[model samples]
Target: MVTGPAPTAARRSVEEVRERVAAVPDPELPVIGLGDLGVVRSVATGADGVIEVEITPTYLGCPGMAAITSAVRDVLTACGHPDGRVRQVLSPPWTTDRITPEGRRTLLAHGIAPPVSPAPDGPVAVEVGGVPCPHCGSRATRPHSPFGPSRCQSMLWCTACREPFPHLTAL
Candidate 1:
């Protein structure tokens, strides 16, 4: 656990910093915050305001990587760690399991289904649940494209809604 400047002086605790970072929505998927999207891996701070965060991209070439970095920096800066550095940790890679329980709720609320539990940490085949139609809330959805809006998502059309939605592909 890294400690930052006193909460009275800095107006934010490490947990608060994390909460702020988690609250910043992903620029690409406005419906999901970075935390909800499982982009923020960790947050820590030193005694003298030396803050650092670890994050990994959902996909190798995901366009939102830069945006997530910027959001992390912006939130820390606003919270009094203007010089903080955000590090990208890609070794183990990111998995849907990192998605917080609240994040899963957010995904479901946004009409995007949550991924299966205990997902693998790297690119590996995992079973994905059928996406419910955002319009009609039906499970009769089929993949339109293995690769959809992004590498992590599959383009699917709901037989009930007859509309395309992004479903998190199997791990």
Candidate 2:
């Protein structure tokens, strides 16, 4: 039998953490996975496999923190890791850009248009120039109110499609 050197404690490779966190499903959207939502920001390992992770939520007020944390822990535990630390950061805020292209496609396929291209360069309206409805691909959508489904999204209805859709509000 051949044996390899024992792995020493150090910040695990970003790739390792990604593979772990990527599988961690979002409590709200179990099908969409956390990695798809672009929530898994930074993952680092310390002595004793003390993993630290930073995540950004789809919405600042999105009420999935506790469940999300538990989900992350579950993935870690499954990976033979016992101690994992997860943290959520609001700085820089969560934006569509963080979301992977695959995630966006997934969201759209699910009938929710991921915010319109991200807020133009700067100092722009959250939903100006109109947001396209991921449902029917119509730009003729209007905000029903300041808020719609969640803080991250506003209510928008498509006149052409005659369907209500969620528009991700750019922060």
Candidate 3:
């Protein structure tokens, strides 16, 4: 395997570091980059020449955190920024609203229904009604289960397509 360049007094610019880290793919969802998934909150290079990356978990206790963190670090090292550090930022807990429109489209293309935002007025259940089916693009869907293979997703069944699909829950 090719190794990263040796550490130097000046490394890549802050923006470059940010862009590289942002492109890191989600371990669980390889099709979506961390930036598109809304997990990578920020990236900055300190005066001391250390690159710091902040990320938020899709939810607390997400098992994928370890893998995501590892991937970020790997990217930094591969890009010749071995001194980079990854931190978790929970202050402004992550929400599905942060997912970009492109990310949503990617999810649908890969057979997963993008999350549907809950009502803005008040608290809502995790399983939002009328979730469209990725397979058939029909809104006549019902909750198959509150939980899918992963904690971040819920199973949904489309009446129109008569197929089951996974819906990323809106948190």
Candidate No. with top TM-score: 3
TM-scores for all candidates? 0.77, 0.75, 0.85
RMSD values, in order shown: 7.1, 5.7, 4.3
Write one digit per residue (lDDT tens) for candidate 3, span 21-46: 77888877778889999999989876
Residue range 1-171, candidate 1, lDDT tens digits? 998965533646779889888888877667888877778888887667688888888878888888888888888878877788899998798877777788777766776666667534767555454666666778788878887666677778888768887777645
Superposed Cα deviation of residue 80, candidate 2 (Å): 1.0
- Candidate structures ordered by TM-score, highest first: 3, 1, 2
Tell me the tens digit of each residue's lDDT in model 2 across 1-171: 999986634544556766878877777655577888888888777666577778887776789877888777766665555477778988878777777788778878877777546354777665544677887787888777677655566778888888987665654
Report the Cα lDDT for candidate 3. Answer: 0.86
TM-score of 1: 0.77
- Candidates by lDDT, descending order: 3, 1, 2
Q: State the displacement of the C-alpha of residue 24, model 1, in Å, after optimal TM-score superposition.
A: 1.1
The TM-score obtained by model 3 is 0.85
Cα lDDT of model 2 overall?
0.73
How many residue pairs of model 2 clash at the backbone?
0
